[model samples]
Target chain A: MDAMPKWADVVLIPLISLILAAILSALVILAIGESPTKALMLMIDGALGSTYGWGYTLYYATNFIFTGLAVSIAFHARMFNIGGEGQAMIGGLGVALVCLFIPWPHWSLALLGGTIAAALFGAAWAAIPAFLQAKRGSHIVITTIMFNFIAAALLNYLLIGALKPKGSMEPATGKFPEATHLPNMHEVLAPFGIEFSKAAPANISFFVAILACFAVWALIWRTKLGYEIRAFGHSESAAKYAGISPTKIIMVSMLISGGLAGMMAINNVQGEAERLVLNAVEGAGFIGIAVALMGRSHPFGVFLAAILFGFLYQGGAELALWTKIPREMIVVIQALVILFTGALDNMVRMPLERMFLAAKRRNKGAA
Target chain B: MELLTILQVLDSTMRLATPLLLACLAGLYSERAGIFDIGLEGKMLAAAFLSAAVAYTTGSAWIGLLAGIAASLGLSAIHGLASITFRGNQLISGVAINFLAAGLTVVVSQSWFGQGGRTPQLAGSARFEPITLPFAEALRDIPVLGPIYYELISGHTALVYIALLLVPVTWWVLYSTRFGLRMRAVGENPAAVDTAGVSVVGLRYAAVIICGVLCGIAGAYLATALQAGFVKDMSAGRGYIALAALIFAKWRPWYALYACLLFGFLQALALRPDVIEGVLGFKVNGQLLDVLPYILTVIILAGFVGKAIPPRAGGEPYVKER
Candidate 1:
């Protein structure tokens, strides 16, 4: 009884939305008196042309992967965990605390410690809003948003007062010990005789991000909890009739979502920054929303969407450096993608469904 | 501890609260009419930039206000098109608008001004100037009432008075007129209103446009009246605080004013922590006050302090059943 095939539903729709967004983005660049074709060439050359560009792109992709998964899981549960920003920021704090206070003998142990701390802190941050949403009737969207501001204030205080290193005027912690320094892509790939840009921040965390994709794919498709979560999302009343606990589903999904989001701290704060910075998460948390939307909340789809966004981000930086195009161009592109894919989805979908139905009727008549 | 210091803090609170009050009221109309808009921040940010840019270019504050309203209305139209016409996710549409403004304003401002996403400083006639009440100097000798009139109420810009004046007007419109009754009813039960032969779409759009106008004024006040120029991301979190205030007020008009003022007082206290430090006999952390409104709102949200129930049909796009 579906209007179109599953492949078209999953792939074709997002593709069309992306193309429409790209066209609008080209017009926006043109409106600012820049050549769209030239900008495209620059983006390709900057993001995908060399190993260096790939290194930076993959680094950003790592951060996006974690966040995108966080958002994807929550989207499956039909809960908007907009507090990814806060959770990720708190995850950075956890990473900072673990790195600065704990003495690890090797990077492997440190990574494990940081990862555990990040997930726990991130999950704990999400738990409060999840608790309220489950027990009380408070909207998760508003509560998560309020939490973002609170997280920012909390970070601002800790960075200035307690976590700050002596003689450093900046609101950031001191660097982690050399024992905890992560190996870059260059080092990680050296054994295979492959060269990567050493200057780039792409590191072992990128592999972790890839593993997370597989894990999320398996978890969402293969697990009993996933069944309950999806069933609850599809119909709360039906799920309740089937004996699924709504409160448990809400809490468990949010905790996993928050944990995935927190894993981004391992990539950005631990892998890249080395020392936790005030603007550690930046707007990557919000970008996760667009990634999840465009990906249709599928892990494999999320991986591709994250790569596309990472390319836009790194390419936009290149445009800022070389041309008159501002870096906010990527943001505009992200917004357009979200608009076309998420909000105005039916605008594109309704027409496509009619065309498909007509084709199906024609094929049946010919048979 | 001193009377003058307390009066000064209260004075600062009035200025800080103006933007929050206007935005809270803006949210009031939209949520009351069954269209949830988290894009108020985005609208305010856009309006702030456009208003500052226009005022700087035309050297007229009024023209800037108009331009700001125009920008906000444009965004509102997009929201209406997506949510009302296409029946898309309202929250998704709102998130898009927010990102749109956050990015577009910076792009446009950087290209137009070349001041790195900032408008040029607006001077006299380009910005709102404070208006002194009549005979304020004549009453300066009076002990308590003189300072209250002169320091607290008399020296605000036109928008402050406009914001204060809108409270009662809003209350009257929400409770009095036929349009007001339809607006409230559309939010609560659009089907009921539709059954009563009212166009639910028309009423919702009207509510959205009203929301846009209020956000426009709120942004204009932030840039032209309060700061005298627009910087990138200058709207900051006032939009979110206004949202918290809206929830705190339970979507009523008068309570919005009180909530905004209370939040604004916290803002004022954060700005000058010495006043708090002197009283507490210890240095109070600035971050705590900055985080207070959010925590308080969360408490209200959790039903620990008070209950805040939203409009029944809020956040759901209305579809006519065949």
Candidate 2:
């Protein structure tokens, strides 16, 4: 028997944590001499007021969905895969290569090629750390963190050398060919007698991200592999006794996690940028950690959390534009969110559980 | 390579190794007491920014060092609140601290200085100038040994020597003292320490606070001694590399010094790509050298080299069974 009901565990806790984070963020704004109420109004208006704002919000959400699902998959296996940033960077490289070299005759075909390439490249980057962790008892957290730096260095070298376009001053590939352009919201909604902002970057990848959420849901709750992964996570010794191979679970889940993280490229690099730049990932990979923690590593929960972060990203930009607040304000808010939801969770949970238990005892006495 | 060229690289190696050594020792103290800290980078970053910001404003590097230590101590207290008092996820707490420092430093800098999140270039007494050891000029004409001593060992800021000095002090404290024994026991078997009537929480907090102080010094060295002022994310990934060095050293103080120096040498070599090409007759990418520490750490971790085992109670929060 639990002290609190399931709904409260899932919904109430997160709400309280979010409220705490918001209160602190408000204090921060006040410290900077800004009006928290005005900031809140502006955030809501810029992020959810109209189709134009929704487009940008959803576009950022697409990136978070892939990365969040990626982190969530690894979390289920009890593996801390902090290298999502590097994997996404390499995934962008894969997208760039597929689009630039394949010369696809149609956008659909190019999307297919890009997806496969991104997943494979991302999986390859994750494989080394996974292998080391499984075979040698190496700490996955440390190994993955190391991989992030190595991947960055590798990407830097490539950007400066082979990846840069001829005579280009920027350390980025040339603009992708027109044939590989993904359809934005405006084009997709027009045939249905609906309107969307044409300037918005939200594209077909948004649907793919939704599909991924469902797929991840099924994979975690309805598969033998998922069971084994969770079993290993709960108790490695017990899982071994139950005939589950830790190595297989570790390798499979990390590869999938890396693949999902890599697949974020479809939205950012292929769908939005249309050309691979040096900073394509833009810290969205690290944002996955906060999302997975807040969502409790559930796919549907991740979907909601991703959107929340998307709103924060777009609204933060709006705040920067309309007020004196700097763009890094969003990062401060993110830190508070992660701190409250992930690290100090018990700070909320302990008190909530006691209150619920007290209320339950009162009802029993009354009965 | 020529002797002069090699000497120069070694000199740079000493300078580069100081921060790694300081940060690695910070990790050693914290993890030794069973509190795993992945936030050394963040604490160092916060310290670096505060140290630079204060130094630039006040024009005294000494005051900057104190401010830096205070800043790092504040973050350490937060980590203690979350992981020690609340028994939350240590790694998660660490990640949060990293992000907090990364974000808060920039926001504060932008609000305070308004130079796009940067402090003004420190000058005069605000920065640590390289010191000329006594008799260095007199010793410079003796021989190869003289040049090496005068050029490589005598020209670093005082912080470098302080970092090197701490290595032996750390060894003596960890091996030769009663508090050191209790700290080590707390990390490996907190139950035993508890049964013996020592306060596990107190020892762990002390270790964490020590870690913070070392990290503060490391950041101060980076901004005030090595560079004129702080740049955003100027510590780069040195905190992570220092963590790697901790593992590579197998949690021993002397081995940590060696690991840091080797990693620092690699960084020094990476900065001079021409030296590799001139000596080895082939061009090598500086990025590869930049990545070598992480790669080598991975390989060592995989046990392809010697095994690097952490302390048994390293990442687990100690719980009283009663």
Candidate 3:
């Protein structure tokens, strides 16, 4: 069978699936006694209408970008690294320790230290599962998921036992020193006279997320290591015969993935909260899977998908605030998107493929 | 003092283990039939919510249990349709189901009852009441065995007994029945089973439906028997823990029982701070204990415990041409 045209395959199918998801979401809203068109308008207005909205949207987009790249890297190695939630938690710990203990004279230096520490800690947490999968044939999915819960419990222990402020009842660390606070989007954009929201959490870390996407693209598509990782993912036995070591590919790819996941903490923890808190990751790791899948694991595609989700999140918040719709409806919308895009993907693709095939046949007959 | 402490721990273990055991057995059926169901949590959550809502409305726990089973079966059918019928990725479908359940439970609950995604508190006949065995008063005078029989074994909701009975029933069906053999065969090698003239899809659907039934009971047990009503995200991570237990058991029924009990014991220990305080002579962090099942599952999967080989055809959808 002939493959579908690249343009149609890459662009058309996802577009159709997304439309289907949106239609279903709209129907669900109608069932709940709300107007779907109005909901969409509210979402757009709240997410993209103002600098304030963009600030929040971009801040969320930054988190998604880090996690999407993380998931994409592991997908390239044929590994499902579901431990991102846990990995990011540990990464926050690393960021907290660096910002708390190190007396950096400048915010930039603190950012550098925290980024390195977060990546290292995330990598370390991921290493155990990677090694087990490489050496012992443990299923990466099961092990990584287990690690997520373990990470949560481990973080809980640290916060309650050692990390909590001397007399604070809350299970969170004391605020970081002011020197470690990253520049918000307003401050960063003001030098260029681009007015932005002062209160929005979008910060310098957003740039870092964009940079990470480029690095991942270069690593996955351009480098020799990238070739080996893709080769292993495509066919491990064939790649083994071609001299790619499964152990090396799996371990390296997962380490990079874990590092990317950990870096997400820099955006949320150091960049926004300026402190380590419980549930800081807030299901962003799980959301990454959908982002990576929707993006087709491409860097540029991931960027677009992340922004779309950012819109949904900010807009969903608006819908909850203004309409009688509960905040959980956002999850339903997101889930429908995932259902159509990731799971029932073929429902859109097979028909599109058939249509493309018939068009080619018609052209042949006419010629 | 020691005996009483032991009894208390054991009692809590029994209560906690019931849900885990039911869910683990549910996963076992699906996985054994070659469908990887990570959606057990979702199914349980749906069941828990629907059952509570129905029970509260109708004032009958029995009808609620039926409603929960029907809701769970509906979800199981969706999973089967996506993974088996549409030939989509099983893991992705499972994740979607989980997300759907989590979101839908809250949305529907709010529409129906309007208590921030919670059902009204179940009371009277709407809840599962503890059942005391005959001669409980007479048995109380006896020492260790008496407490074990009357306290630990008896005097719990009927769902606990049903879950315990399912262990042996699951074993008998899987080993002694033709359907069980065919189900196992379908999981290990669907092509071989197809070649033998048995319908692979039929067996898988059956396994999935049974899995849904078990998950429904587990959910009903949680909402009605244990907690008295449904709360949002009430299943917590128990489904994943049950999956881990299924892995630790290496997909066997009896071993699944043991694995669930062990996990439940860990959970009970974590919940009861006094237990650790009593044993260690000081506070031992419950968080560590809270994470013990997950940590142990990772270790077990890593081959520190033993070798665990999943069904060869577990995640693959059988395509005849391929």
Candidate 4:
């Protein structure tokens, strides 16, 4: 057997799988009595046409970037932290508390306060599952999944009982103080004489998400901690022999992952909603698994995958609003993409690898 | 607690535990054959929707049951194909199935019923009725045994009995039957089973198919016996709960019964928090009650109560290496 080239493995496989998923999605749309091509056009236009579209897309991308990076970091440690959903929910609680109680003179200082609070809350949520996996031999997947439900229940209890505004029927907290409000893209860009969409929710958190990508890239590829994490993931016994404590590595990687996931609260809660909503996470944590898989668990890959999903989410909303297509259809489309890219990946890879290997053999014979 | 109150709680426990028992047993078969099936929720959801739709259309609960079983088996086949034939990652395949079922159930429900991801309510014979035992009335006056027979056991739907019966059957088959030995061996060491000339793929597919059938019954019970119609996302994380119960049971059939009942008891308490608070004279938060099962699941997974050892090859796809 011959190995696939780096370019083909990294680029070609996912590209083809994505195309396959797109075709299947088109077929589903057509079956629902809609024009597939027209749907595609609407999706592109609604998600990427102008500053408004880009604003929503970037806002969603920001959320995905945090979650996708969280999943990718854990994947490097051979851990599946499905509790990102729960961690983010708790992180939102942290942000809400910070914005509610503390009096910040400026948004910058508030942002710093909210970030630390969110990270600590999220890491605390993840620490239990990490400890279980390391010391108790419990499966991280099961424990983390259970934590997601528990987190939802906890958030629900808090919002309705302790966090709700006075005499409000809705299960949400009061808006943050005006000083805690983050500047949106329109406000940020206007100073440079650049016009942007005012109503768009994309804020300074988008830049923070981008910065996170760079930080994650450096941490994974250029740092000793990253090397140890990857080494432990690749071979647990080998890492143990090399004096890398599984308990320490698991705890640290999961804490970092949880913190990153928690940081997504700054984008959705402080930046967009300006309040803690019940469903602030909105399934981004689950979508992060698909993004991480599609991106090959690399920082750059996760960034691109995040944008694509952000487009799907914003575009899917447009489809539901404008057409007969149900909002559930987007979930179907997303599932197909995940199915092809993550589960049935070998269906595409095996054939491509064979073709590449055949070509290499013929070239060698000719030489 | 009064004796009557105890009987009522036990009765509610029976009703609540039915679906969990069925799904947990379903998982037992599949996991014992080295196939990890986290898609039980998806299969149950699919079955619940299909059964309700069919029952509404045909006006026959039996036909609905058959339809639900067939739909569940179809999903199991897909899981088997991905994990067994294509040798894909079992967890990823299970997750995809879950997503597929969630989306497909809603899409199909909207298209078929035009009721916005819900089925029309089944009335009269289209819904399951509690079966009265031959001597239930006469046995109702026997003091200690009266409430036990009439209230706690006798007046439930037929599916509950079937689920209870499956426990012993599952135990017998896994320990006493030839195919059961092969299935266990395949889970523990597929290479050894292969060397013995027993087809690993065949045994696994059989296990998955059985899982599908049981999950189908579980779903049908929820839609028809418990509720009169199917609602979107109706499974509501029950499959994951069942998987947790399976872990808590340590993959044994008899223990699966107790684990499901314990969970069911918790659910019954959570459902009627007012009754519990009145009896215990302590106000309980409904949301905290809801979180108990999940928190317990995590505790069990962490081996706080007892260690859980998974089948050696549970998540691995069987590949014959030369």
Best-fitting candidate, scored by TM-score = 1
What do the candidate models score in CA lDDT, each in turn?
0.93, 0.92, 0.90, 0.90
Residues A188-241, candidate 2, lDDT per residue (tens digit)? 999999989999889999999999999999888899988888888889899999
Which candidate leads the pack in DockQ? 2
Off by over 4 Å in 4: B141-144
Q: Write the per-residue lDDT of candidate 4 for residues B164-209, one digit (tens) a residue.
A: 9999999999999999999999999999999998899999999999
Model 1 spans with C-alpha error above 4 angstroms: none
Where does candidate 4 chain A have its weakest 10-residue lDDT segment? A330-339
Q: What range of 10 consecutive residues in model 3 chain B has the weakest lDDT sum? A: B284-293
Clashing pairs in 4: none
Model 4 C-alpha lDDT versus the unseen true structure = 0.90
TM, every model: 0.99, 0.98, 0.98, 0.97
Could you tell me the C-alpha RMSD of candidate 4 in Å?
1.7
Q: Chain B TM-score of model 1, please?
A: 0.98
For residue A317, what is the lDDT in candidate 4? 85
Question: Between the candidate structures 1 and 3, which one is better when assessed by DockQ?
Answer: 1
Sort all candidates by DockQ, best to worst.
2, 1, 3, 4
